[model samples]
Target: MAGQWVEVLGGIMEGSGQILRVSTALNCLLGLLLWVQKIRAGAARHA
Candidate 1:
């Protein structure tokens, strides 16, 4: 199997400005997309 890697973007990482790459997995990424879809769907239902 190939190795998995997640790159941290941005040129600088200040004290509280660190963007950790934690959503690189398939399930983790899908969960985020689904969550966003749910939010949009709620707005559409109300509108």
Candidate 2:
């Protein structure tokens, strides 16, 4: 039982580390995409 607990916690820690990194990268990409769209919309409005 104790071994299972350790294994589960280790797995969660390892998985979450990668997920955090991926989510951070995805968030940045989405933010940049939104910013680009906003700029384009503003330019279109002006024109």
Candidate 3:
């Protein structure tokens, strides 16, 4: 999977920081790295 990337929606609706933290840990354990976007977007929308 060289030069490949996976997209994940990171927002309050998706379990917020908890999901982000767990996903990152799992990626690390699987020897893969990922990039996240729109962190806390839902919270921002509500605000």
Provide the overall lDDT of each model, using Cα atoms, as 2-decimal numbers. Answer: 0.30, 0.33, 0.67
Over 1-47, each residue of candidate 3 has an lDDT whose tens digit, in order, gives 53356666776467577768876776766655567777677764543
Candidate 1 whole-model C-alpha lDDT, 0 to 1:
0.30
**Model 3 residue pairs with clashes:** none
Q: Which parts of model 2 have CA positions greater than 4 angstroms off?
A: 1-14, 32-47
Return the lDDT, model 2, position 22.
54
- Model 3 compared with the native: what TM-score? 0.55
- lDDT for 9 (candidate 2): 24
- Tell me the lDDT of model 3 at 23: 67
lDDT order, best first, reads 3, 2, 1
Residue lDDT tens for model 1, 1-47: 23334333333332212222332343265443211112222222344
Error of 3 at 18 (Å): 1.2
Worst 10 residues of 1 by lDDT: 34-43
Give the poorly placed runs of model 3, Cα more than 4 Å off: 1-4, 44-47
The TM-score ranking, best first, is: 3, 2, 1
TM-score of candidate 1 relative to the true fold: 0.17
Higher-scoring candidate on TM-score, 1 or 2: 2
Candidate 1 segments whose C-alpha is farther than 4 A from its true place: 1-3, 12-16, 21-47
